[model samples]
Target: MESLSCSLFSYPVSKCSSFTRLSRGIVFASRSDSKKHHHKKPHLPKNLRHRRRTELPPDFHPVLHPVPCEGPPSESDSAALPRDYDENDVNDSYDGNVVWESDEIEAISSLFQGRVPQKPGKSSRERPLPLPLPHKIRPLGFPTPKNIIRTHLACSARQPISNQIYKNPAFLISLARDIRSLPPEDNVSKVLDQWSRFLRKGSLSLTVRELGHMGLPDRALHVFCWIQNEPHLFPDDRVLASTVEVLARAHELKMPFDLDKFISLASRSVYEAMVKGFIKGGNLKLAWRLLSAATEGKRMLDPSVYAKLILEIGKNPDKRTLVLPLLEELAKRDDLKLTQQDCTAIMKVCTKLGKFDILEALYNWFKKSGSVPSVVMYTTLIQSRYLENKYRDAMAVVWEMESSNCLLDLPAYRVLIKLFVALNDVSRTGRYFSKLKESGFTPTYDIYRDVIGIYMASGRLAKCKEIRREAEMAGYKVG
Candidate 1:
């Protein structure tokens, strides 16, 4: 039987190369003889054959037949395969084992009960929802105790209420003088709280001013250190000014207040505040020191503040000594805006200092720039030259003033009369005297006195008598 089976498989294997030709012949041949011939021949090597033939029973041909060789099926046949099939029914008699095997695999996979393990790096926990942020708390819009303290300090320093409200001892002795006088409906607690906070801030100025008005300058000094050590809530000009005034008053009250420290604090204020404070305190030296520090440290002062300082200093007889040097320093700064007031102040300072050389340079600078000097500026220059005994230069400035149509007022005439009289130039003095009268400005007794002195000093008795008569005619009570 094995021999028969081997022969059956061997015949096909040996003729496999000629199967195409044999297939054509078999189609014409009788079926019985073809079957008998197909059962012959087993002479091929065993090792080259398929193992399935050896495992099967000899008689079990398993309906061995060649599948029709029409090649691969068309798309329409492939499309007819069922996508979903029952695994239990796949092995039914009509269907092949091949279909059963594929369907069983899909059914087994669909019945998977356990979850797959997560990837090595990932977590199963879903991302938690983000938490909302808390809202920010806003500050109160109303003024704080600090604001009231600052405002009260600023106002007190600027205009001391003590001097105006509680100047007398009776008002000072009454503890509730102003407090009791306030309307009953007023917020006394708020007012008291503000005052208490102001006191606690250790502002010596406000304390001193308040106490001084209450005739308690002694108690004011007792808390001077507290005021000195208190942290400045607002270190602006107004605050600094208050601090300075407080310290200055403390010093006046016989307290050992540090003048240098006070001046240093004053230096930090605006230039106007520092200058005015020093001037008011009659400390011109400290004013100059603060001015120098301000200019050197801040690099520039406000033009208006600088002008105010210059004007204030120029008007003071003692402080005027510092003007020329200050003006020179001011002129060196290119950023300084030289207004008419500044120019006039500089010219006046130069005249006072007899710095006619600088004045000439300034006048030429103004003229070349085509800027017409105002009456004050021209008069300042003329007065300055006259003070320097430069009669010709002084007269030249007067001519310039007249040409520019800058009216020479009484002050200008007084300056000219004084200048000419100083030079003992009788002819020039007489000429200016006639012009002064023509301008409808009668000479004062001082001017007449100056004219008479100039003529008498030159031994011109007749000219002196004529000046006396003119003085009498001009309503001067000449002795």
Candidate 2:
């Protein structure tokens, strides 16, 4: 053992192959030489001999010490070692029963099972923990008092009610009605003040009517002239009638106004309205004078104005000669087209005067001019026939109206019933009354009065009383 230790220092085995070094550990040079040197152990190298002896146990053998080697392993040392036999070669030769030593396995198990703490190795890396799974998020709630999410909207209503005060025509009419209800006074300062502030297009007609009713013709004329100044305002017939009546009265007052003064001051509508108004007030001479002046001024007279004046002049029995000249002048005009209303008015005048030839001539002219007479015109013709006691002729005209698809209204039916009742034909009257009802005309107090009078005249007092009660039930005064 001593010589073996000394030989380890003498020759290093660093260059030796792994198999050669392992073979040298398992084999010896000779069994006899080993026995001869059994009592002589070789000395360790100086550095190895100086290693701390206290690190080893007392039972540890020096022969088991580790010695360092350098350079190549010696060939002679390797040759002296025993031959190595492979354990795998023995299994190829025979099948044998193998046994493990239980005591040796228990020793290794006991070494691991011991509770002694081991010293840490040079590596300091620790095992990483598994990443945590993602957490779930909750949804948002609806806006409410508890949620406190909504805000209040700002207000948009700031304009005053007075800004829209006169927007309603009823309010203006009521105001005029109230003013007219007051006592008659020449001082119209209050009306003027109200007019300046709240007057609109609708209020103009009401103001003129109220002023005319109050006998303040000058103030009414002032209001009518004010309408001429306002471009947006066109005075309607009600306003025109009132203004013209005031002008007719003003014309008779001997005011210092000439023809040119009047013409320059008033519009064509004013002059036309004045002519009609004068005729209405039983002053045909003044109406004729105005019409002649309007004609001489080269101003085109409205067809309605011409027809109306002619009809009114024809109403006067002494002035029947004047109507033909007016009709001749109307026929000569090429630019002025006759309206249905104008033709109907002319027909009515002719019917009133019993001029059937002229009436037929007017009707033919209107038809040729492409102006279809309305239901009112046909009813007028029927009434004219009835007035002459020509009942069959009137009925024939009604049939003509029906063939022409002209639907007679409630007034026309009333006229027919009246005509039949005049002829003492109760059955025909009843048939017309039923037709009136089927046409959805609810009988008013005036209609019921006519019906009651007819029944009483026919000696049907019970039917008259029944109609009176029905009229009373339908919210009409029986008396």
Candidate 3:
């Protein structure tokens, strides 16, 4: 076995050293020989390395030896160290340097509160037992040497609750397991009370977010209620966002989760999960209710939510009528800048409701925003004018659309067909009607009626009957 030795050297120890000083001349000796030791003076802390040693007091001892490491003692150069201070070796352990207060012990003891075994003497199987340390300090599942326990204590009692919860993986794991095992109807406060020692604003929010990821909407909602009742932890925007995520995950969004509370705090991933859940449930009224809560400044939602709205509207075109209230609410928020798509949706609603003034206002708003009006916007305006019997203005919008050189969409083609039919211009009406079919624009029931009416008025029963048959083949119930 390799041998150990010591060499006495007097050096000034820093006042800030954690371990208590034994003697001024105490210095540790190396166990192995290598040139690397010559390069480094010793393992002195950075602050102490460049400091010069101070003069020893007149009464200072000439030599003192370092306490040896824990192992069998091999050969040692005894002549290098003095034997006079051997009695001081008993105080060398690192635990003796600092003291733990009563409050700290109580804080640590709270971690294993109910899990500690109450009665130690009576056990059915006691074959493999541990050494008897004091019951207060012996944590459950402790297997390390007793000397290392102070490190654990220092780690636990030294931090605030917010940081402590994040550091203890065992604590977080136990918390998740306990919450998962709870029944949906049982009070979440019970589980929360069990771990009340570690509760904080950050911990509560983290639990809710994790529950959302685990898909536990019921428990998440319950714990969120507890957060509100607890007076110490002030629930902020981050906390509100996490709670919203839990409900949105299960497609259980409602008024309690006011998303406008933190319009920017929640992430897109949460909204994506919400949109998917809504699509799977085959209902959008719940989603619309939640979105409608968004006030003036927060009028815009995540793009993913709007994309899903478009997808759902495509699958069930009649649902467009359901968005009328939300559209009107958004249109009233003058400060809210809207996209072309938003303009189109609002105009469609305005036309259906015969709100000609609102439609004209929306068109003027978009025009003032420095963006050229889209083909659909102009088309909605033309149809609105024609509905109000403003033939002069309707024809004027057609002239402007042609001057803008914008490609006509399906709505523009239908408006032209209706306008020409109203003017008793059969030739122009037939031209636009053929283009509608060739462009794969499925005509609505109203479009078919207008076309058949114009044909019958001009003495063409053969053409009217053929158009009626086409409408029936396309699944429209003609009267």
Candidate 4:
């Protein structure tokens, strides 16, 4: 191994191996000898030998170590340093104070202590530092400030019920009529979208009401069902009431299967609407069941609801079992006071049923309550008495209405015409027809047909023919 080591380099003492061959026969020392030689200063290259320094320049300062001293370095530090201080050993001993050139130290001191040169402004009397170029000034492409504020104000204004377009009952009625007038083939969604553009806000309840008035309760119920999925537009009581009335009226007028799907899917509000509508449509049995369900659920049962149910069920002798229970339930609640509308609904229902006794009882109740009867209530009462063959009482009610100077409506005039016709009093029927004309109300086809029938019954063939000719001229289809 000793001979092998000597022969590895081109030492003159040993040249036994070709591996030690070099240009100019230069020798490479072994690692141990090279490290021992480094204890003295390293030999400079031939080119740098002339500029070599015996010591560091006075201006070249040593690195000021941020590492703490365990104890002051001994004066014999150079004697203690290893013959070859490995780069790794130096770094480990002094926490890596790697480089400290004069330029680096100057650059670092300039970074923290130097005031950054400012650009010349129009006028600068020690102006403050520019605020960081304000985050690169990007555009978001939003509306202008004025337009934004106007839009916000408009939205805030529409939040109230009074100003909202959908809350305008008259507007809703007009929209409904317009929709009803459209060709059935017209796309309803397109029509609604067009109207929505003009309206500030749309309400589900008003839509239901319009649909109901247009006799499109099926569509209204469809809207009602759809709004369930819309988290924002939940239906309240008034919307439910309109939907119920529409459904009931539709049920009465349409085929049995028309609303069966919606009926099966009816929620609480819809169930209540069904109950009220059924009562209005004279479906006593179903109405009673719905009312019972509503009562059991402790849902909102107003006096008007009870009155309608009572009026309908009380008329049907077989359904009499249901009437008493509802009345008793109503009596249990003190919060409900009968409104004029409730009284009118009851009177109207009783008139249809020809239940004069109940009508008379309702009349007595109204009297005792000191509530003035409306024109509709008095008209209904007269019609009920006339239907029950109590001519004197009916006429007395009419005389009272005249004495009170009540505004007799179209319904009252129609009833009077019919009553006179049924009694075969031709002159009186004609007089009531004259009164209807004087009331500025247009006569319906049914009234024309009744008038012709009365004339024919009284043996006025010539007059009937003349009236029929006039009716035909006036676009009335004479049967």
**Best candidate according to TM-score:** 2
Largest lDDT belongs to which candidate? 3
Q: Can you give the lDDT of residue 475 in candidate 1?
A: 87
Q: Could you give candidate 3's per-residue lDDT for residues 140-202 as a string of tens digits?
A: 885676663222435668766645664354565466667888786778777877666566556
On the 0 to 100 scale, the lDDT of residue 146 in model 4 is 58
TM-score, per-candidate, Cα-based: 0.41, 0.44, 0.37, 0.38
Clashes of each: 2, 3, 0, 0
- How much is 120 displaced in model 3, in angstroms? 99
lDDT, candidate 2, 1-479, per-residue tens: 11122232232222221111112333111111222322433333453435444323221111322234454546665554334523232222122222223333333333444433334565587788877654423345653557432221222135333334434445555555655655666344555455555455554666665666566677776666666655555555556666766667556433235876786677776677777667666677777777667667766777777787887887778988777767766776887677888788888887877877767777777778776679988887888888888888888877788789887798798778767767777777777787788889987666677777778888998988988898888998866
Q: What is the C-alpha lDDT of each candidate?
A: 0.53, 0.62, 0.63, 0.62
Tens digit of lDDT per residue, candidate 1, span 1-479? 01111111122122111221122223111122223333433222333233333332222112223334355645644344334322232122112211112323333433342233234567778899777554434554764565332233335667555432333334323323454445646533333334333232323344345654554434444434333444443233443454445444333522226644544443434335545545555565665676776665654555555555666677767767667667677667666556666666666666666677877776676667667788777777777766666788777877777787778888888888888787678897888888888988878888888888888899999988888887788788666
- RMSD of candidates 1 onward, in order: 24.6, 29.0, 28.0, 28.7
Residue 31 accuracy (lDDT) in model 3: 20
What shift in Å separates residue 344 of candidate 4 from its native position after superposition?
A: 1.9
TM-score of 4: 0.38
The TM-score measured for candidate 3 stands at 0.37
